[model samples]
Target chain A: MYVAVKGGERAIENAHRLLAHARRGDQSVPEVTLDQISEQLGLAVDRVMSEGSLYDRELAALAIKQARGDLIEAIFLVRAFRATLPRFGASEPVDTGAMRVQRRVSSTFKDIPGGQILGPTFDYTHRLLDPTLAEGFVPEAPATAEASTAATPRVTDILGRDGLIEPSPQAEAGASVGDLTREPLNFPADRDLRLQNLARGDEGFLLAMGYSTQRGYGRNHPFAGEIRFGEVEVEFAAEDVGFAVPLGAIELTECQMVNQFKGSATEAPSFTRGYGLAFGQSERKTMSMALVDRALRARELGEEALAPAQDEEFVMSHSDNVQATGFVEHLKLPHYVDFQSELGLLRKLRQEFAEANEAEPMKEAAE
Target chain B: MAVLAHAEAGEIAARLRSLALPDHQDLREPENGLVMLRGRIGGDGAPFNLGEATVSRAAVRLASGEVGFGYTLGRGREKARLIALCDALVQSRDFGAAVERDVIAPLREQLLARRRKVAAETAATKVDFYTMVRGEG
Candidate 1:
C-alpha cells in the first residue's frame, strides 16, 4: 500500500529546462545583474532578508534572482542555504538606543528629541504612477537643516521616566530566552519567543492579523509611540577573547506601540507597550508586527483572549510563511493509495444501495 | 575594530601593502558561518533572538609569536584574513605604529566621513510641519 513512485526524471528535467529558458526572457535585453537587484530592487531584497531571517543582502539578492522574483520562494532558498552553514554563537543583545538615526518619528507627540526625519519615504508620495521613473528620472537633492542638538531618547524612555508606561516585565537576573531555531516552539511561549516568531513572520499575514484587531476583533487601540530606522553595531564575544568584538553594523526598523491598559484590582492603571524589531528598513512589517504583538498580549495583561490575533498558538504557528507554503503545497505530491481506498468504499456503497432498490421493486411487483 | 569590520575589502588590502611585515600563518583558516543576532524584548528588556547574519572569521600567528584574530560580517574570507594579519601586525612591537598610521587611522577617518555624509543627507529630509489657524481664513 505504501509504494514509492519513481521515474519523473525526464519530465522534471524538461521542466527545469523550460524554467531556465523562461527565467531569461528576451535574451537580447541585458540580463539583470546582482548589483542591480541589490541596489535598485533594494526594498525587495530587504523584505527577503527580514522574512528569510538572514542578514546578507547579496545572498538575498541572489535568492531573489534565482527564484525569478518570487519573494517567498527566495525566502525559502535563503532558509535552505542557511541550514548548510556553521553557526558560531549568539551575539550580545543589540543596543537600539545608540542607533545612528537615519529616520525617526513619533506619532503621539508633536515634537520629539530628535526632530522627525522622513527619509526616502513613500508615505507622502501620490499613488499615481510616475512615467518618468521608467526613463530614469533623478531628482535634485533637498537642502539640509542643522542636526539636532538635543539628546535623542526613545519615546518609551521619555514616557517611562514619568511612570506613564508600565515598566517592561523583568526576567530573572540571568534567565536565558528560548531560540526557536535550536528548540522546538511549545505552546504558551514567552514574550521573547513570540517576538522572535513575529519578527521573521510573513508581512502580509501579520498585516491582516493586525488589521483585524483595528476592526474590533480584539481591539487594543494602539498609538504609534515611535518608529526608528537606522544602523547599529553587533558585538560578539568569541571563545578565549576577553572582550566582545564588533561584527559591523546592520540596519534595523523598530516600532513601539503604546496601548492603554486599565488597571487590575491591586495594580495601578498605566499604558502598556508592544515592541517590534526587524532586520532592515521594513517599516510596514515592523508596524504590523507591533500591532499584533500588543493584541497577542491579551493573556499576559489579564484581558479576554477573544480574537485570532490574540491566540498565541494560532498566530505563531501560521505566521511562518515558509512552513505554511510547504504544508499547503504538499497536496501536489502523491496521495494515490489513500484516494483509491476512498474511491473503492464509495463505489461499494452505491452498488449495495442500487441492489437493495432493485430487490424492493421486484418484491412489490410479485406481491 | 568597528571601522575595520565595516570598511571595504579593497580599502583594507591596499593599506596592508606598504608595511614591511614579518611572515604570518593562519591559526584558524578563514571560514564562513552564521552568527545568531539577539535583541531585547523592548528596547531595554529581556533578550530574544532576532536573526542570524553571515560572517567570516580568521586568526593568524606571526613568526614572533604575536597572535591576531579577525572577524567580519558577510562572506568576505580574504577580508577576514587580511584583517587578521593587520591585527597581528598592530600588536607586534616594530610594526604596531606603522599599521596604526596606515590602516587604523585612515579607515577611522573614512568611517567618520561616511557617517557625516549620511547624517547630512538625512538632515536634508527633516520635516517641519505647520498647522493652519481655523479663524485666520
Candidate 2:
C-alpha cells in the first residue's frame, strides 16, 4: 500500500524559499550584520574557522548567517568553499617561542617565567546570564596593566632541561610535510599528518575521544604544561629572494600536554609531549586536541593501543564532520525504488509462506 | 640584497596602485579569491591550518614584452593589477630606476614610519619587574 510521492523538485524549490525567509526571521526586526557575528559570536566564528580549515572572519561570519547558526553547517560551507581556491605555497613554520602571547598559563608549575597571564578566559565565570547585556548596557572595562614584553618560554622546555621529559625529535630542514587534503591518509600516519588531521577535525568528536582517554580508556596522565594564545608572524620565501620574508601575523592557540610514560626495557621512564595548535582562541578544542593527540601516540611511544581513541584509523576516518554528515544525511534522499523492490520480495515470501503452511495441514490430514 | 618583507612589498604595491601604471596587456585579469594559511607547532613540529585569508592576484605583459605578476591580501583588484604592471616595469632597464624612485621609495618610507609608531606604542606598554631575596632554608 505504498504510494510514491511526486513534486519533489517543486517541494525542494519551495523549501529553499522558506529557508531564505526563515534565515531573515521577522522582517520588521533589525537584521544581524556580519560584523555582529564576527565580533559578538567570535568564538563560534573561531570554531568554524578552526574546523572548517578556513580563516577569513568575513566568510566565517557569512557562513554562520547562511547556516542559520548551525556551526557544523557553517564549517561544511567553509570546507566546500576551500576546495575551490588555488594553493599558493606553504609558509615557513611559525615561531611559537617568539609569539606575542596574550594569554599563557601552565598547570605543571606554581609560577613559571613570563608568569601566568589569564587573558580573557571564562575559566572562573559563573554560568549566569546577565539581563543587562540583552538590554544593551555596556559594562565597565577591567583595569589594564602594563603589558610585559618578556619572552614566554614553553613549560615543556623546563622539564626538558632537567632530562625529565623524553627528548623530542627534530624534523629535518627542507623536509616535505604531507597535506591530508591533497593526498589520501595512509595507515601508520606520522606525527605531522596526525596533527594536521586533528587540527581540522570536529571539535565534539575530538572532545569525546579526549574525554575517553581521561576516563581511563587510553589513560595517559597528562598535565597541561602550557596553553598559550597569541599572534605569530607568517613568513614565506619568494623565488627572487633567497631568504624568508615576513607576512602579516595570524592569531593562534597552542597547547603542549606533558604525559607520563612508564619505563620500558630499553629506556627509562619519562614524560612525553602531545602538541596541538589551531587558528584562533579555541581553548577547549586545543586542550582536547592535545589529549587526543597524546592518546593516538600510544603506538609510537611503544605502549599498547588497546582503546578506540588509540586506534588511528577509526579516529581519523570518522573525525571529519563534513564527510560524516554527508554520508549520514544521504539516507534522506529518495530510496523509494530500492525500498519498493524490497517490499515486493517481502510480500512474495509472505504469500509463499501462507501457501506452504496451508499445504502442510492438508498433507498431514491426508497422511 | 635584503629581501623585502611581504608587508613591504604590499605597501609598495599599494603606492604604485594609487599612482597608476603604464598601459599593458592583461595576461591574466585580476581575480580576488581566498588562500588557506597553514602553521606548525614550535616552528618545526606538526603542521596545522591557521586559517583562510582573502587574496587577489593578476598578471600583465608590458608593451616591451616583459611579463609581471602581482598578489596581495584582501579584495583589491586594481591594486593587484597595478602591482603586476609595476613588476613588469621593474624588469625593464629603461623604467626600473624611475619606478623604484617614484613608487618603492615613498612606500618604504611610509612603512618605516608606521613601524616606528608601532614600536613607540609598544614601548609605552613596557613593564619592569623587580625582585628581592627572601629568607629561605
Candidate 3:
C-alpha cells in the first residue's frame, strides 16, 4: 500500500534547466555536432544502437550527445525515441553467408577458405597510450590485395558438410516467429526467443557470464569457430512492391562458437555450435553473447545447470539493462509513507522488547 | 531500387529537381517508421527477430494512374518522397527513360563509387601469412 505525495514541480523544472546548462559546458568551445559524434565517437553510438535494439546511427549519435556520453542513458533515450515510430514489417532474414566480409578470422582452423583476412583489428596492437593520437596523426595507406571473388563459406558450414558438427535445428514450416517486443517472455522459451533476448542483452552482464563459462562454470570447451564483420544486404518483401527489393545494406558482426559435445543417447558425437549477431562492427559483444548462448543451452545438451550462466530464467530476467536500471533507480523516488510505516513498526517492537526485558528482571528478582 | 535506398537525400533531391517532373500527389505521406530485422540461427538455420531499424517510406500516385512506393533504410523524409516520385515516373510511358537517365543512373553511380572506395580500403587490410617450419635446424 502507498500514497502519492507530490510537491517538486518547480524543483523538477529547475533541475531540467540546470541539466541543459551543464550539457552545454564551455559554450566558447565549438559545440560537438551529431556528425562528429557519428564519425568520431562511433563505437559509443554502436553500443547504444545494439543495446537500444534500434539501428539508426544518427539517432544514436543524438542520444549520446543528449546523454553527455552516458551510454546507458543514451540507450534509454534511443529506446524511448524508437517507441514513437510505427513498425513497417520484419525484413527477410539477412543472408550473412553472402556478406561482403570486411574482417574475417577463424581460430579453429588456420587454413580455412577465404584465408583469414585480418581487416582493421586491434588484436596485434600493443597497449601503449600514445600522446600523438590526441594531436591527431594520419597513418600511411595500407598495401592492397584483391578481395577473393570466391565466396567465403562459413567455418561451421565446412564442418557441417563432413558431419563433424551437429546440424542446425531445422525451423518448423508455417510457424510464426517469436517477437519479445510484442509479447511477454514465458519461461522455457524456445531457442528463437532465447536468441532474441540474448541479442539485446547488456554487454557487461553477458561478458561476465561468458567469462564464468570459460572458468569451468558450465564449461563447454568453446573455440572461436569464426568471427566476421561485414556489410550484408537487407531485403524487404514489401507487399505493395510485389517482390522482395534490396532495402539497403547494414554492417553486422557475426560470431559462431564450436563447442565440444559429448554424444547423448539420442544425439550423435559431433561438435556443437553457438551463434551471435549484432547490428554493427561489434565483435566483442557478439563473442560474449556466443559464450553465454552456449552456457544457456545446457538443458538441451543434457549438461548440468550448475552455474549462474546456465540458469536461463535468472540470466534472461536480469539481462536487460533498461529494466534493471529502472527498478534499481526507482529507489531514489520518494518512499516517505512506506518508510514512516516501517519506522512506526520498529519503534513498537523496541518498546515491547524493553517491557519484556523489564518483566524478565522482576521475574529474576522473584526467583 | 537499391540505389534509391542507398543514395544520399541531397543527391536524390538535386537529381529529381533537374528533370522538371510532373506534379505528383502523395498517396501516403512520407512517414518514418521501424522495421524489425531478422537473422537465421546459424546463417542457415531458424529465423529470429534481430532488432528494429529506422526506416522512412512514402507512396505517390502520378496523373497517369501508376502508383509508386518508396522505402529507404533510414529517416530521410525527402529522399523517400523523391524515390516515390521516381518510381511513379519510371512506370509511366513518357517519363520512364528521361527519369532513369537524369536521376537513377547518376545516383547508382554515386552508390557504386561509395561502395568501391570502402571495398578498396577494406581489401587492403586482408592479410597473407607464410609459415616457417623448423625441422632439425
Candidate 4:
C-alpha cells in the first residue's frame, strides 16, 4: 500500500507510442499535410502565428499538426523553437501609410479618404454552419484594382495639422530600439517595451483586460479611428548600396484608436491616441491591443491608475500564456517528498499537544 | 524579391529548370533542415521561441565562378537546387539581364495578377456603414 509510484519511464514511453497511434487515427485515411493546415485551417495557423509571434506559415502549420491542432500547444511549440534562433539584422520600421490596404475602416468618421474598404470580414455574416461544406467548397475569387502608389492619409493627420490631437512621436532616425529577447523586463517600462509585451501577450488575457476597460474600469472614449489590414514592404539597409533595399512584403494589421481626453486641472482638453500593430489579419488582437495600450498609458497621461489594466507591472508580468501554463501545470508533477515532510511534522506536533494535556490533568488532581 | 519570398520553392525550381542554363556545380549541396523562428512580445519585448520551420538551402556556382545561394521555406530539394542555380545565373555578367528579364519579371507579373484576383474577389463583399444625424435639427 505504501509503495511509491515508480517505473514512469516505461509508462511514458508507452503513452508516447499510443499518442502517435492516436494522432494517425485511421490507417486508410490520408494524413493531413502541412500545406493543407496552412491553407485550409488558415485561421488556426494565423492564431498560432499571432500568439507565437512567428510569421512563417509553414512552421506554424507544422506546429499545429504536431500539437494536434491545439492553438496554445502549437504556440508553445513555436515559442520553444523560436528561443533557439539567431537574430538577423533589424529592418526599418514599416511605413503603414504606404500599406497596400485590403481592409481599411473607421468607426470615428462616417466616411474618410480612400473610403472604407471592408475587404473580407465576418462582421455582418450569420453564424449558421453549412453542413454541405463537409463535402467540399471553393470560394469564388473577387474583383481587383490596379495597385496605387498614392499614400493613404491617416485620419489623425487631419486633426494633427490643426494641433487638435497630441503631437505624434517624431521619427528619430537610428534610435536605439530595445530588444526584449536580450533583456529581462524591468517594471515601469517605457512605451516601447510595454507595447512589445502587449503584442506578444496572450490574446484572451488582453481581450479580457480590454473588456474590463470598456466596462467603465479605465473608461476611455475609444473610437477606432482606423483599422487597416494589408501588405507592407520590409526594408533593410544595404550598406553596399548606400540605401535600404526592400527585402519583402508581409501582411500586417494596424489599428489607431483616438480617445477624447477631458483635460485635467493642469492640462488642456485634446484628443489622445493609442496604437496597435500585429502580424497578419489579427483584427480582434490588434483592436484589443489598442484599448489595453491606451489604458496602460494612464500614468503618462496624468490620469489615475484605478484599473487592473492600468497597472503596468501586473499586466506585463502575467501576460505570457507559456509562463502561466507552466506554473499552473507544474502542480500535476510529483510532490510526494514535500508532502511527506509536512505529514511528519504534523504528527510530532499532535503528540506533544496530547502529552501536555495529560500532564495538566495530573497536576490539577495533585493540587 | 517579394515574389521569390512568397512563391513556393518548387514553383521557383520548375521555372529555373525550364530556363535551361549552362552547366553548373553545387557549391553547397541543397540541405533540407529546420530554422527556429523567434518572436518577441509586442515586437520590442522579450524574445520567445515561436517554433522551428522546415527549410531547404543550397548554393550553386556557374562555370565562370559566379556563386549564388538559395534558401526556401520548406523541404523541396529540387526547388532549392533550382533557386541556387538562378541565384548564380543572376550574378553571371552575361546571364544576369536575361535571367532577370526571363525569370523575375514574369514571376512578379504572375504574383501581381494573383494578388489582384484575390483583391477583386474580396472587394465584391465590401460593406459600407452609415449613420444619421439624429434630433438636433
Candidate 5:
C-alpha cells in the first residue's frame, strides 16, 4: 500500500541530531582541540585562510573540525561565517617592503644586499617517510643569529631602474576602475579583476593552468624575479582620527615574475612582470599564480594572445571554485520536473519514428 | 511592535544597519497604489503598472560609502529610498557579512512571524460556526 510520506521538519531535525553524533564520534576518545589543528595542521589552516579570505586560524581550525577535514567545506564554512560579519572599515594596504623578513629568496641574484634567508622551507628535504613519526615526534629548535640590517631591493625594482621591466603602476590611480564584484563581469576585464580572480582561484586549477603555459601552450620565457615571505604590517585610516593606524601584522607570500617582452606599434617593448600575493606561505600557488598572471597579460605584453589562460573571459568567469562547486553539486538536487519534461519529449520522438517507419511500408519492403 | 516590524525586514536591511545605516523609522500602509514592475525595460528603470503592494525598507551607512536604494511593490517612495541606501551600503567594502546575518536575517524573520501571527488572529475572530440537527419532518 502506497501511503503519503510527510514530516519533513521532523526528518530534518533527526538528521541534524545524527550528524552531531557523527561529528562527535566516541566521547571516550580525546577530542581534537582547535589549537592543535591550527598549530599542527598549519598548511590546512593556511589553505582555508587563503581560500576562505579570512585570517583567523582558530576559527578556520574549528571549521575544519566541523567539516570533517574537508578543506573546501571548511572554506565554505569560513566564507558563510564571514558573510555574516558586519562591515567595519577598509584597511590601508600592507607594506610588503617593510615586512619583518622571515623567508626571502631571489632566483635572479646569487647574493643580494640582504643575504638570502632560507628561513624554514621544505625545499632541501628528501621525500622519504619517517617511520618514527608513527609513534609521534617533536621538532627541535635550531640556533640562528645571522641577521642583516641592509634593506632588500626588489629584483623587479632593479630591472625597472634599468628601464628593462615595466614600472609598478599606482593602485590609487586605478580606484575609478569598476569592481567586478559590484557589476557582472563583461568581456575583456582589467588587470585588477583578473588578479583578484587569480588570488582567490582554486590552487589546483591555477597550478594546472600555469603548468600549461610552461609546456609551450602560451610560452613566455619567465624567471622568478623575486619571492618573499614574512610578516607585514596592515594599516587602516580611521575617519575620526584622519590618520592611518597600524592594525597588527599578517604573514604573506609575494611573488614577482619577469618575462621577456618585445613591444609592438601601440606599445613599447620592455620586460613585463607578473605579480602574485597571498595571505600566507604559499610559494607553489604564488609562483603558478605569477606565471598565469604573465600569460594573461599577453595583450599588454604586446604578444599574440592565444591560449585558454590568455582568454580573460574564460579564466575570470570559471576560476571561482565556490561558484564552480555550487553549480556542479546543485545537479545532485531533485531534478524530477525537468526529467519528466525530457522523458515526455523522448517518448514523443520515439512514437513519431515508429509511425514514420510504419507509413513507409513500400520502402521497408524494397529494403 | 516597532522592533518586531523592523526585524521582519531581510538580510539586505541588516547589512545596511551593520554599515551604520539608520534603522527603518516605521512601516505604514502607503496611500498611493503600488507599482508592479514587469519585464526589463532597458535603461528606463523598472517597468511597472498600478497594483497594491506591502512595502518595507530601511536606511544606514557610515562615512566611507553611500547607502541608498529601496524595494517596494507599491508607490512608497520613502521605502524605496531607504532600500536604495541599504543597497549602496551593502556594495561598499566597509560593510562586512556580519551585518547581513545579524541585523538583516533576524529582522526578516520577525516581520514574517508578525504577519503570520496577525493572519491567524484575524482568522480565529472571523469564525462563524453553524451546527445542524437532523430531524424527521
Candidate 6:
C-alpha cells in the first residue's frame, strides 16, 4: 500500500542524531585526537590545505575528523570556514630567493647551484609493502642533519643573467589589484589574477591538464628548473613600521620550469619560465601547474596554439573543482520537471513519426 | 475635455521636473494646464520631454576620480538630481581615475570610523563574543 510519508523535519533531526552516533563509533575504543590526525595523516592534511586554500593544519585536521576522513568534504569545511574570517590585509610577497633550502631538485641539469637536496621524498622508495606494518608498527625516525647554508641560484635567474630567458618585470607597487573572490571573473585577465586563480584551482583538474601537455597535446619541452619544499617566513607590512615584519612561517612547495622559446622577427629568442606554488608538499600538483603554465605561454613562445591545454579560456574556465563538483552533483537533485518535458517531446515525436509513416506509402516504400 | 487638459499639464510638469527645471505656474497653457518653459531661457535650458519612465537617475562627479550614480524606481526629481550630481563627480576625469583611493578607500575609512565611534559610545553595553558560545550545543 502506498501511504503518504510525512515528518521530513523529524526524519532529518533523527538522521542527524544517527550520524552523531556513527561519527562517535565505539566510544570505549577512544577517539582520535586532532594532533594525531594532523601529524600522522600529514599528507591528507596537506591535500586539504592545498585544495581548501587555507593554511591551518589544525583546522584541516578537525575538518577531516568531522568529515570522517572524506578529503573533499574536509576541504569544503575548511573553505566554508575560511570565507567567514575577516580579511585584515594581504602579506608581502615572500622572497623565495632567500628561502632556506630543504628539498630542492632539478630534473634537467645533472648538477645546478645548491645541488639537489632530495629531502624527505619517496622517489627512491620501493613499492613493496612491509608485513610488519600490517600489525600497526611505529615508524623509525631517520637521522637528521643541518640545512645547507650554500645560496641556491634560481634556474630562471641563470637564464636571465645570460639574456636567455625573458626578464621578470616589476609590478607597480600598491596597485589595487581586484580580489577574485569579491569580483566575478572577466576575460583577458592579467598575470597576477591568473596566478591567483591557478593557485586556488583544483589539484586533479590542473594535474590532468598538465598531463595533457606532457602527452603531446601542446607539448613544450620543459625542464624542472627547481622543485623546492620548505618552510618560508610570511611577512606583513605594518603602518607604523617602515619595513615588513615576519608574521609566521608556512610550509610551501614551489616549482619552476624552464621551457625553450623561439622568438619571431619582432621579438628576440629567449627561454621562458612557468612557475607554481602550493601550500605543503604537493609535488604532483606543483609540477602539473608548471607544465600547464608553460603551455599557456604559447603565444609568448611564438608557437601555434592548437591544443586544449594551450586554450587559456577553456583551461581556466573549467579548472575550478568546486564549480565542477557542484554542477555535476546537482543532477541528483529533483530534475523531474526537465525529465517530464523531455518525456512529452519524445512521445510527441514518436507519435508523429508513426502517423507520417502510416500516411505516406511512398515514404515507407523508400525507407 | 477638462480631464484631458489636466492630464496634459500634469505630464508637462512631470517632464520639466525630471529635466531638473522649475515648472513655471504662470506659463501654463490657457486651453490646457500644460506648463511650458521657453527654449534657451532658464538655467536648465534645452528641455526635452521624456514621455514615460518608471525610473529616476542621478549622477555625481566627485573631486576624486570616482563618479557616483544612483537610480531608484519611480520618479523622484530631487533625489535623482542629487544622485546624478554625485555620479557626475565620481565619473569626472579628475576623480574617476583613482576610484579606489578617492572613493572606495574614503568610503571604507568613513564607515569604519563611524562604526568605531558608535562602539565607543555604547562600550558600556558591549556584547561579548562568548555570549553566544554558552547557548550553543
Displacement of the residue A145 alpha carbon in candidate 1, Å: 3.4
lDDT of 6 by residue, A20-125 (tens): 8898899997899999998888988887877777666777899999998988778888778766544434555655666655577777665677666766678888
CA-lDDT, candidates in order: 0.90, 0.77, 0.88, 0.73, 0.62, 0.60
Give stretches of model 6 more than 4 Å off.
A1-7, A21-29, A239-243, A265-268, A357-367, B1-137
Candidate 3 lDDT over residue span A343-363, tens digit each: 999999999999999999899
Query: Residue A273's C-alpha lDDT in candidate 5?
Result: 76
CA shift at B73, candidate 6, in angstroms?
47
DockQ of candidate 4, scored on C-alphas against the true complex (2 decimals): 0.24
| Top-down DockQ ranking | 1, 3, 2, 4, 5, 6
Question: Highest DockQ: which candidate?
Answer: 1
Residue-level lDDT of model 5, residues B1-137, one tens digit each, is 12222322344444444455434332322222211111110101121110011222334443554543343322244544445454454565655354445555566676557545433333232213355678733
The interface RMSD value for candidate 5 stands at 25.5
Query: What is the fnat score of candidate 4?
Result: 0.14
**Could you list the iRMS of every candidate?**
1.3, 4.7, 1.4, 6.2, 25.5, 28.5
Quote the B-chain TM-score, candidate 6. 0.29
- TM-score, per-candidate, Cα-based: 0.97, 0.81, 0.97, 0.84, 0.69, 0.66
Which parts of model 5 have CA positions greater than 4 angstroms off? A1-8, A172-174, A264-269, A362-367, B1-137
Better of 1 and 2 by TM-score: 1
- Cα miss at A134, model 4 (Å)? 3.3
User: Best lDDT goes to which candidate?
Assistant: 1
Model 5, DockQ value? Answer: 0.01
What clash pairs does model 1 have? none
Write model 4 residue lDDT over A37-88, tens digit each, in one string.
9878877887787778666788889999998887888989988876665433
Docking class of 5: incorrect
Regions more than 4 Å wrong, model 4? A1-6, A26-29, A138-151, A171-174, A238-245, A262-268, A352-367, B20-88, B128-137
Using DockQ as the yardstick, the better of models 1 and 2 is: 1
Report the C-alpha displacement of residue A274, candidate 2, in angstroms: 1.3
Compute DockQ for each candidate against the true complex. Answer: 0.78, 0.24, 0.75, 0.24, 0.01, 0.01
lDDT of 4 by residue, B68-87 (tens): 76655555766666776777
Candidate 5 Cα deviation (angstroms), residue B8: 39
All candidates in order of lDDT, best leading: 1, 3, 2, 4, 5, 6
TM-score of chain B of each: 0.94, 0.80, 0.92, 0.82, 0.42, 0.29
